[model samples]
Target: MVNTKYARVLDHPESSIRWDQESPLTMTVETREGEIETRYGRFVGGPADGVEVVEIDTGVMRVVVLPTRGMSIWKIESKGIRFGFDSPIAGPIHPSLVPIDDPSGLGFLEGFDELVVRCGLESNGAPEHDEHGNLVYPVHGRIANLPADALSIEYDEASGRLELIGEVMEARWFAKRLRLKSRLRVRAGSYRVYLLDDVTNELSKPATMQLLYHINIGSPVLDDGAVLEAPIEELAPRDELSAGEIDEWNQFGAPQDNYVERVYFTKLCVDDSNETTTMVRSGDGSCGLAVTHNVNHLPYFILWKNTAAKSDGYVVGMEPATNFPNKRSFETEQDRLVTIEPGETKSFRLSLLPLINEQAVNKTSERIKSLSETFEATVHRQPKAGWSDMS
Candidate 1:
């Protein structure tokens, strides 16, 4: 029988053993399926200097995880198909370089180029300011900018499961104290990557929170005529600009100059097990990517289409969130905020499957179609009240 192995990659409080390219820490283990390799290293130059990265090669897929960026997934590649956007922002940028608290409160975009990034711990959505115009919460919260306090790797040879774990704390004096523990798992010879996250309240008093997973894709997997398919139960445009093309919400077009973004908020239909899947496929249906999650935890989804010029960031975002990405005050008004008592924890799970061929893409498309056939989806031509700020 095979055994489970564990290794400590980083412990900021206990040691300063950070790895660089010249001397990266790597571990390879033999499993029944094949060989699994994990490497830990830090970027040395450019905007990504001092950024810690963990890369896992599962034979079928390769995933790059950023421990210094709230355990976000930088990129994923399987069978020569890359799954990430090419943003103008040359990142994995170090948190120090991002002015999250700038005057305009839009500094969060300075480093937002990840394939998957978490959007909460305290407040998410739009930036918030007080009556005096003082910034209270920066855009998309602070979790993405907070570095992990500890990181480790675990491998179960028998099951051929490999996992990278990280812990990030978002705490302060006289305010909310939350901890995010994230685990990224992959199995040898599999084209799927799984994420398990636990957000815990560490304060003596109860606290409220918001969370959203910003999963983005661009280029090859998201080209002209590409389509987004999901079992949407209820759907509404985010604003009037988006409402103009509500009929074509699921469709994508070629990148254009001066293209404005369109957003759609949706409540999805789930299966008997409370699970649902969303997918984006190439124009010819030759390749695609799918996201699977449990609806019991993530009750809302947002589709962001920004098909701008290549140099201006041509990308689409498939977000599964606890609540809509509105201002904290607006979300609170709509009663979309989540509250946790002291010592309590909330868990979230998500999986990404790369459809490497036409057959795989068709199979997943049929599954979504079957699920959607269960109910007639409601499509709102305009932004709906209580769901959109403009409404």
Candidate 2:
């Protein structure tokens, strides 16, 4: 297989050769260039000369970048520890087309906390840009464009911080077109994205566009031990009419053992102390997950999962969105969607915090239990008569 040369390095490494090991061919790849000896895997309908599978094992994270027919991609895995490989941080550098679920309809990146979009207005056979790059939906005779993805990505050896930059893609009407700069710090165990609205021409348009961070938590992170704790009250759907059945339990704390989906336009105050919303994932609470949102802009949030028989139920797709499922003003033959006028935009920020033990979850767990008790006492109290039967 592909392991003949890699055998030597696998058993013994000179320094630290970030590497790869996969089966069928059983190939291996290390960062430090040696004989560069190897056999290759067939990348489907690619050229006769196949591509190399790169595994970036930079301690804090082991990112695997591979090229496929669907999307040229990169999968990030935690280094030293190999438990975090089930998810992918999919990439699209500018004119990107990837992990293409269905090049049409409402499909997005499969596994990623970030996506950098660029230039384009029309979508799904809709009219966005004209022959020359003039906006059909001009706010003031101008078209907002998205930036090229991947301005640069820096991986620090000492601290293990990944400084990443994704330029803006375009938006309709007059909004800013600026670069989105952010950093993924593994030690800090956090990621933050700054919305840049410093584009020329449309500075007067007063930069505006909707942005959301979609993350999938592979729970085991959500077994019976997991508990949901957040500062939310009166969680409502931006599309109150459409939220329908899913909106039934919007304001309550959810159990990790049960299946659920819904959104919340909450009233929970997030002072600095309440900056974290956590999920305790094991029975004894040895590990957990936490997420913090840019509460200012993403006042609206969505918690959805297609876990019925049709879709697998291993992980939960908890999306902290900036707006509703559909934009405010998108009208279809079936329904009228809300829309923003010219020169308008929206943005949001959030962090995926990992709380890794019982100590981390103790306070968070108590907070959730107290809130759940209070909510049940108010909304789901016992009928006085039922209590009388015991008497």
Among the numbered candidates, top lDDT falls to: 1
lDDT scores of the candidates, listed in order: 0.87, 0.33
What is the per-residue lDDT of model 2 for residues 23-140, given as tens digits with 9 covering 90 to 100? Answer: 3212222323211112223322212113233332333333332222111122333322112213222122211232222323212333232212211122211223345754333211
- The local lDDT score (0 to 100) that residue 172 gets in candidate 2 is 36
Model 1 poorest ten-residue lDDT run? 8-17
lDDT of 1 by residue, 1-391 (tens): 3232323321112212244333223688799988898777776656777788787899988888888999999888888888888887857789999999997789999999899999987887989899999999899999999999668778899989988889999999989889999999899888899999999999899999999999999979999999999999999999999999899998999999999999999999888888899999999998888999987778899999999999999999999998999889999999999999999999999899989999999999888988889699899999999998877
Q: For each candidate in turn, give its C-alpha RMSD to the true structure in angstroms.
A: 5.5, 12.0
